[model samples]
Target chain A: MPTDKEHVHNRIAVLRAERGVSRRDLATALGVHYQTIGYLERGEYSPSLHLALRIAAYFEVPVEVVFSLTPFPRLGSTT
Target chain B: MKGTTMEPTSRKQKAEALREESRRRAAERQQRRDEIIRATIDQEVAPRWASRAGRRRLVGLAAGLLALPWAAVVVCWYLAPSDTAMWATFALCLAAALGFTLIANPLMKVTRGVAGAPDRLLDERQITERLRAQALAHRATLALLVAASILVSTAVPDEGNVATLPSAVFAVFAIALLATVAALPMLIAAWRMPDPLPDDED
Candidate 1:
């Protein structure tokens, strides 16, 4: 519906930790290299919408829950 | 139909079973290949060339690699050594080239997300990196070729005079430049690639 090439911050590491999924397992499930998982978590590599959706699906959460335009707040901090 | 040993339903079932087996085997093969790719990244890309220092060292080495052929050409230009010595020099340079490529190519592949990989095999991020690297390499190589061509043409002596550089040296230079052309993209991509994120759990 809209477009922006800027970075899309994600909470992959937090989600992965909460879900107890190793980077290797997540990468294997997503059909990408493990280092890609690392890159994505660190906000160095941005995923396409398709890949973003796939990742959201893998985590069984809404896409918004995984990705957001603004920086996600610290996990335990009161906003 | 009356004479047939099997009914149509049984034949269909057998065909489905065969198709299922084929699908299973294909998936199995894909999984195995994925494992190999993951292992290669873990061992080669992960263990080597991940540091800023290591990457910088390799980038410097890549510059030397580009200069390598030119160095060989210069040697031949200055001193047309004995035939045996010339051959030995060629052999040594060849070995060095091979060794350097073997060490550098993995880093390039990681940097460029499977450098030169086909479209189907690469993800969006990989495709972008590859395209950017290739575009840069193409422009750089074209400029180098043009400059070299101009220099060589200007160096050609007036009609009927002896060439300043030996014909053999020109041949060697051309060959070396050709190899450098092939190696340039990988080197550029490798140099431009950022150091990968740390491996620690985030």
Candidate 2:
């Protein structure tokens, strides 16, 4: 049912890939365990908004650019 | 241009693979924990509409049952004045029985709801917090019961009347004494134990 947390964040992996950063380096930058970085990148856990923003900031991009709401619903014409 | 690939020894490759597998497992465990927490919160805080529907059904059932006794009490009161105490006692007993039944019913449901749930939700930190709070509450209740019992025993004389003091007072004393004594072992065990799982299975 998507229980809120399932609106996954692909941001970590996307940012890491773009910057060509290793998981260990990202973990060090994030001040979290390396496994945490791996978990974040795999979308196993959704980061809090604060963590999301921090990740986006680390990538030098807007939060929207880094994180996205997936299975994007189409905007219909207003009735 | 293709470069020559260097193959690593089996032992080194095996070690590297094992480390990667361990990291993967850790990540998976953390993810599972997060998912379980999210699900629990959702269940606990189900939509207001759903909760309201359930409450309405329960209330309807209760009201239907209560109507019969209420009607009987009103009729009996008008027809027979002498049976007031009998009816009152009957009502009180019914209420006590219902209260006890209701109390016991929810324990099983709550246990089922958190069945197979991860112990991380009730981690060592949370267990310690709960034990501390419970200890304080138990002490406070024990103190109150003791004071009440002493006051009742002193104020009310052991004259011809047996039911001079409130039955509730005696019941509270008995319950508190038993609870306090029973809790001693649990408190001691909890204090002595190191990082016990909140649930038995965990």
Candidate 3:
């Protein structure tokens, strides 16, 4: 059922890359297995509301910056 | 000069060394990713019973419950006064059914599902496997029932006295029915487990 729904595009991979954070490192910080981080990064899994908030808190960013229904704008590109 | 020969060979060797180092690092990264994936699957996919110590207790309880009725029936069959044996068998069956409803059912409630119901502890993939297994079990049961019906109907005498059939025949049929019924749940539960990932040959 989760798979049937539209994917919730995310900036997790970009954010992790910008921070130079490996999946294992992020997973450790979040107290989840590394593959869960990989899944989240690839948009294969949608995090629960609680987990989304936790991830945003971990990154020191707002939830909207991390996840969105639409694709995020390219970094440093003119509109 | 000797220097020209040495310089070209040295350049080729350096190039080869760089390629090897790159290949090794690539292999290391792939191995790390593989390990992470395996760990995640091992952590999340296993059923509660698979990793939990409480499975042993649950198994012991189920085995004891199933065995109790058979033990009673066997003791009654051999030890009871000849006249009471049949009545004892009937009584034992009734008692077992009562015990299952009153005791074992509630004890098993955590893992319990109606024949086709999804187990709460199972993940989506496991639930899919369980459903497939349940369907197969249903089909097998249906086949068995149909075969039994045909055999029974054919074995009945032309006189139409169903009671005239041998009691041993009925007992055999009852045992078959009981075994099939008992196995269905166990089959589905066992089938729900994911297969181990096959080793990569390369």
Candidate 4:
């Protein structure tokens, strides 16, 4: 279920965890504040298109892989 | 013979002491970083929504602030009944406005991202939230002022005292401006907070 009207869900936390990057470290890379990263991960705020693309570029992932309008599937789920 | 061996042992002891100092410094640095992280988490993990009590307190403070200038004006009108007294009331209200700017502005900048103070850089989300809140508050203030003006015009018959009327009007506008400035940021910030995250939910 999408919490915000923006409807832009993301895998930012998962990717950052997989890469062993701290929020501060990733925020530095993305040229944003650490709290901004927290807001994005928690769905409390949605990033601009420019920021979303920049974040995707930072993680070296396709925009679709990073964000979606629908809920992401749980890892290892049968569905 | 003992002296020669003692020299090498002394060198080893010096090296060991240096290593211990280096390790201690590293531990201290790590501890400092941990403290910073803890503080950041404390700030960021606060309850998103303001409590009922918090709202009441803020409204009370705002009301008190709004009352001050009017109270001064009334006192000046009754006690002195001179142009000088009116001027004094204006000065007092101006001082109150200045005090609010000095004390409340920084607080708002830090907590609510108000005033767009550069030192405390607000993220886009905070900036947007404040803008939305201020716009609503501004409209409300404008409407209230218009209604107030109409009521005052109807109630207070024109005595053709140009000097007194203009000053009174000026004082009213100044007080209104100060009240709006003092109340808007706090109201917006208080209203924008979200509920805390439950342990089971995000």
Best model number under DockQ: 1
Query: What TM-score quantifies how close candidate 3 is to the native fold?
Result: 0.36
**Per-residue lDDT of A1-79 in model 3, one digit per residue for the tens?**
1363667878988888888887778877886645556656667667778878988998999999999988788989887
Best by TM-score: 1
In model 2, how many backbone clashes occur?
A: 0
Better of 1 and 4 by DockQ: 1
Candidate achieving the largest lDDT: 1
Instruction: Show model 1 residue runs off by greater than 4 Å.
Output: A1-5, A73-79, B1-38, B44-48, B78-85, B101-122, B159-165, B200-202
Q: Comparing to the true complex, what docking class would candidate 4 get?
A: incorrect
Model 3 residue runs over 4 Å out of place are: A1-5, B1-202
The C-alpha interface RMSD of every prediction is: 2.2, 12.2, 7.5, 5.4
lDDT of 4 by residue, A21-72 (tens): 8887887787665666877888877888888999899999899999898889
Query: Please, what are the lDDT tens digits per residue for candidate 2 over residues B1-202?
Result: 1232334466678999999999999999999876765354234322321333543343344334334343443334344434564565356446644743452222212222222234454423233434554576577557856885686567665787663543433443353345344333233322322211122112
Q: What would the TM-score be for candidate 4 when compared with the true structure? A: 0.62
DockQ of each: 0.34, 0.03, 0.02, 0.19
Report, for all candidates in order, the number of backbone clashes.
0, 0, 0, 3
Where model 2 places Cα greater than 4 Å from the true spot, the runs are A1-79, B1-42, B46-121, B158-202
DockQ of 3: 0.02
lDDT of 3 by residue, B49-108 (tens): 443244444445554555555555454535554556666665666665665555333233
CAPRI classification of candidate 1: acceptable
